[model samples]
Target chain A: MSDRLPGFSTLAVHAGAQPDPTTGARATPIYQTTSFVFNDADHAASLFGLQAFGNIYTRIGNPTNAVLEERVAALEGGTAALAVASGHAAQVVVLQQLLQPGDEFIAARKLYGGSINQFTHAFKSFGWNVVWADPDDIASFERAVTPRTKAIFIESIANPAGSITDIEAISSVARKAGVPLIVDNTLASPYLIRPIDHGADIVVHSLTKFLGGHGNSLGGIIVDAGTFDWSTGGKYPMLSEPRPEYHGIRLQETFGNFAFAIACRVLGLRDLGPALSPFNAFMILTGIETLPLRMQKHCDNARAVAEFLAGHPAVASVSYAGLPSDKYNQLARKYAPKGAGAVFTFSLKGGYDAGVNLVSKLQLFSHLANVGDTRSLVIHPASTTHSQLDDAAKVKSGAGPDVVRLSIGIEDKEDLIADLEQALGA
Target chain B: MNHDAYPDNYIRGILNSVKSIAMVGASPVNVRPSYFAFKYLAQRGYDMIPINPGHVGKELLGKPFVASLRDIGRPVDMIDIFRNSSHIMPVVEEALTLDPLPKVIWMQLGARDDAAAEKAEAAGIKVVMNRCPKIEYGRLSSEISWMGVNSRTLSSKRAPAPTQGMRLSLNRMSVGGGDTAASDRAAKNKSEQS
Candidate 1:
């Protein structure tokens, strides 16, 4: 293929797939088997030795999943990609490769509450530390970086609160410290932003959300831009040092550009065993096919909803980057020109009780913990996701008690507004 | 098909004994299949030495190019030929002349020569013609099944659980495995209490 690349719509449909070679099936078949038969013992030896590449078991790799991996890698302009069980699994595996025991990584404070909980509590058990930095303040990222910092993580569009991150500015800080910049592009998806174009070394996604567009599949992906030199200063041993388990093969010296992706597969996913089942892979792949159409509609409806909320007397504040009045509007214009994504929050004038009441009254919007579904969704973080966090911590995480988060869907704008209007009870 | 399918044990033996490979006609150009094959094998931890006379002094994927298989300085265990049908004989002839000849001669896709194969086999070197090491690795490793191709082997037993940290679950209800608020609270309380 020449430099004139295929458009997003085309890549979403065809990138890592071809008609089924065996049966001539147009759709990718789900290979549900756990292990594959070897041609002979030598073929098996080469596979086990890393002297060759192939799926040994579903836990390590699968046929249906590989297609999804390639499709996302192609869309993100990454050299290679790895597909895992969920969006959170993507973060865990990516860090598993980067952070050694007792090491640290900097993350933006404005992240999904689930991620904040994951990084703050779950990761600590693995001996990995999270140093929080304000995404709005680029300098805060630089200051958070210490000698132990292996990576810097941020969401392209901060969850709950629709905010765009200054990826280029923060990437520079990561560059100065000789670490990779990883951007979680789940909310914006590749339709709105390709973080690699903005200097991110790796782009991650919760494919279950917008990419799947249906919220029916639980999947995650790690896309390696193949930019970072893992061998530099020999900080990343999992990639640099000879792995004794794999017969003393050093991943970086061998893999080069796709080494990080390879490391995540053989080292992280292999050991952690958070493998995506082939059935889920097939569903997520089907969902990705309509990502472009669904994302555009999701943004259009969200822009309308954010505007409606901004005007409502019952609403205290609408934190949607699509609105010019919102704090992240300028950054949204620069980073996500298509739109600032569909998931955003609006605080109620009645505070905690109003936020809870508004969600309960909404007829169309499902009150659920998930996002990026075709149907709109609403949640009160103060009562559910962020309930455990103290008030001071909750505010810092953009999930204050007065906030009501909405994951606007690809429905008609007028119908969505009417539902919200009735729910506001004005 | 000009290439013979060797026994599984023989192929396995060759791959296991060999440590380094000298890829003849290796290209630095990204679009070429040779470049990818070279990259994939190198990443799999093979000491892949790319031999390209055209880009004599240049580096492909960080490793400097060598003028010929003989110029790799160390003992090359395998010679992976990426040249066409007409050039295979000459490439094999060059491989035979090296002080420590390669133990195997692998012809890339469409690069086969019966005479060269006879020569290499006569020299007690294993010969795999019109086949790619990259493809062979994947096929043998069972990794190629991800493409919906049939993996001839079948087993009924499930893969054993990982011995390390908590097992990750991807079910719809609990997406990050055990990332429920209750677990978070427990972990948080423990941290504060400590």
Candidate 2:
């Protein structure tokens, strides 16, 4: 709202939110209705024709969801945002807009196991294909690209292993291929890394995780950097072609910078029908207000835990990039100077039994399939999240039988360590 | 915002009353948009009749495929046209020949014909053009709100549902789907043996 750029915390609190004109409501109230009343006949026509901007229906747009979308877009330095039901839903809609039938997209090999399942299995049903490349080997990404490749997808900070992807290097491959680079910034959030600033054209998030800062709601968002030239080659027809649905108006021509976001909402979300509830939007927005405070503590506590585990005789390995001895320490410093985030993995010398036992024994941590909460969480991924994946996939995702994932929260350092110590029986 | 564009009340009413849908031009191929729409409609508990000529007597989503609207041999509530714009007239003509004519003639995202719409309306049937049923069901039922988007209408009231021993966690975490600790132990033991 001002010429002077406000800090992240301020944007988290104030962006896209103002006092309610009708009721002076300070807190964002959930607009829980199925339909909004029209002022006049002509007004309704304009909204549907895309001639005017307002809430038409919840599936397409809503005022409260608009606030969350704006807050996230501002924080991520994107032109606009479209919030959806889950991280998986965001990915579905993002790819739906980019790829047609039989088209392929290259993805970094190291990623959240659920994402791997989504890309490998569920997406195939939609006729979209995935070609995998190891994040460690940047050249693998280049080799995977073909004329049919429509986009390049990677994570800012990969899940489980806490590895930092070379966003800049992969972005070059995407640019050369004349495709957009999509980065899932769920782990890093905008606090640790802004993928768009480096070279990413689009950023996606599962606000159900850290951005919500609580494990209470499931939500996701797609932020359009508004940088890609959708009209460059006419490859993306959804954005460039005329649409009979909305009176043949090309989305890119009408909604300039954030045309991708518009297409996702109007076409993808409209048909797929994964709309985020306003109640969830309210909760996520509330969680994000204190993101700056929570993220710093999460990093500090995680660094301490990684160090403790690395030295433990019973611990076989610790895989947090925050640790000086970790393989991704330099990348972490370069990409996420503030911290390498709070989710990391470690393996036990006692093996599978020890991994399962540690999760069950931790008092301060809740054993569940979630991360980025105010409360510490732990899970044996092999027996839970990645239980569905095969052994090869488990290893590729950094979720092996001996591995235990830790989502360090904003708890006291000593308390978390005490819980870990008791759990480890050291 | 143009208020006259989407007739919310009209669409909502049709979605509420409609029960069964005969999806014409439905495909068995997973990649086809018709296939996804058919699956989504079926998942939403719609009695789906997939009409694909080549796949007659075959099954899509466990619903036996029919060669045409007349071949359904049952009272069809709605005829969802997934065919191209050029095919709308024949589809509507065939839909009219059903034993009990369908109450609605719905067109998919890009399929629309004013002549067919007029014909259907003259027969006292509702016509929804250039729209999708999968999306309409979500909007009408308020299920789309699960994704964190605002539904726009606000109320302090909530519908009661059956809940027992369920802790209201921050994230809407549900109880286990009957997977017991024994199962995990068995899986782990099998892995260890290998």
Candidate 3:
């Protein structure tokens, strides 16, 4: 596949996906169905019981989503993929495989606000605990560890505020603990960073953002590095031990290296039922094909926007890892060498009200809670996404009262800057 | 970047697996907040030992009340306080005295005793001030599972089931045999209309 697609441009337009045979359509079709018929009762029984591998239901697997999965896996250099309902779904599914009741995992404190909620409250209800470690302080991670920890997670480039993680160092810690490293590669996209290359055993993405490109669909994906030794630990019963639901078939033993992906599909998706829509999968597949091109342009536009805000009289500070003056710039250069990504935070000199005014005034940029679209987006996170968080959590997530988050898109640089300028002026 | 000295993978596994909880100021009265709070948690399979010398040796909410933390036979994962902040230090002190201390000391809502919190914090316990686990659970997960709504659903009512006979009557309006002003106007309209 790599040989067939020699360049980013070639890969974007033609990788993993082939023309539809039945309709002769070049684009991937949306496979909208609740269930699929097996060849015979024996095949159905085999699929249901894990003796054979095929789509038993739409929630477990789909033909259209499979193309998107394979494409992202190819792009990220992973063995296999799992397409989920949302990025949050991807995280939940991954945890379901790695963690049991009373298990724990460590995550970087600097993550998306929703992730904080999921880890702190939702996962806690199930007895899965998350130990918070500062992404900047790798030692805190080691100090926080107890005997029950199962995995280490971080974002390649964190959301809202684009702070790059030292994946290599974190991966080293995970290796020492005999655990897998999971990286949320949504912000960096595969074009900006390949987490697997930095030693991340699993890569997760909210495809609704960058990979979907347009705000039309919602989806998420998880890619397995096929690197972690699941069988080594007696910890993961769903993967290492025989599953009772599947007639005692051991996923790790049967799938060999890509057992994590197989487990996510056959077990997590089968039971939990957070399956991505085929239309969403198709849209994300289309977006991913042009990821390299859009990502580069998105970076270019974002860098210009960051530079503009850094010097603006009305702006107090800008927080893009791409900015040379940024504290995380050095880390960004090492980890996400392609680009520091499109999302960033900037504070208004006039404070919170003025930030809201600027958002209301901006015409080109949509004021929604979403990021990674081809269209620029702006939001006062304190008033929206982080509103549910208490003051302590809000401050920790960097969504303070005066801070305004922007997700730069692949638009004309001058037009985007001019819009920001007009909005800031108003 | 200064790496966190602690490895992450070894830290997260045991943060929430609280095996035992010492309920400070657990109530004997069924209507009190402490009663329901203790009951919900005790129902969730946590080893809950109630503390309130007033209710000592009494079995309320299905758990026996003890005079102090020392009275409990085993170590606990957390300490859930239903008492006010001012009266917490002595309990926290006793909680700290146990060998292999509790990991979390959660102060119930309206229980903001900073002095006690600091002491617990100093003792390496994660202190969650003024938050209820039951409320957090309801907000975070679907523990209720729509069972309450489904049980009283219209179709399920008036069925030939023994449980529904009382459930249907209790769920409907209870009209007394003697008509008052409110019922007389409603009853007059009912008699004249048909």
Q: Model 3: per-residue lDDT, tens digit, B1-194?
A: 00111111111122236768888888775434565566656644567788888987678756778888887878788888887657777878888898888898876644556677778878788776544554333212211111000010011122222110021112211111111122123223322332
lDDT of 3 by residue, A342-393 (tens): 9999998999999989999999999999998989999999999888889887
Using TM-score as the measure, which candidate wins? 1
Candidate 1 wrong stretches, greater than 4 Å:
A1-3, B1-194
Candidate 1: how close is chain B to the reference, as a TM-score? 0.76
TM-score of chain B of each: 0.76, 0.74, 0.64
Instruction: For candidate 2, write residues B21-49 as lDDT tens digits.
Output: 99999988654557656766675567889
Interface RMSD, per-candidate values to 1 decimal: 18.2, 19.7, 30.4
Q: What are the per-model DockQ values? A: 0.06, 0.01, 0.01
Q: Which ten residues in a row have the lowest lDDT in candidate 1 chain A?
A: A1-10
List the candidate numbers ranked by DockQ, top first.
Answer: 1, 2, 3
1 or 3, which is superior by lDDT?
Answer: 1
**Residue A73: error of model 2 in Å?**
0.2
lDDT of each: 0.78, 0.79, 0.73
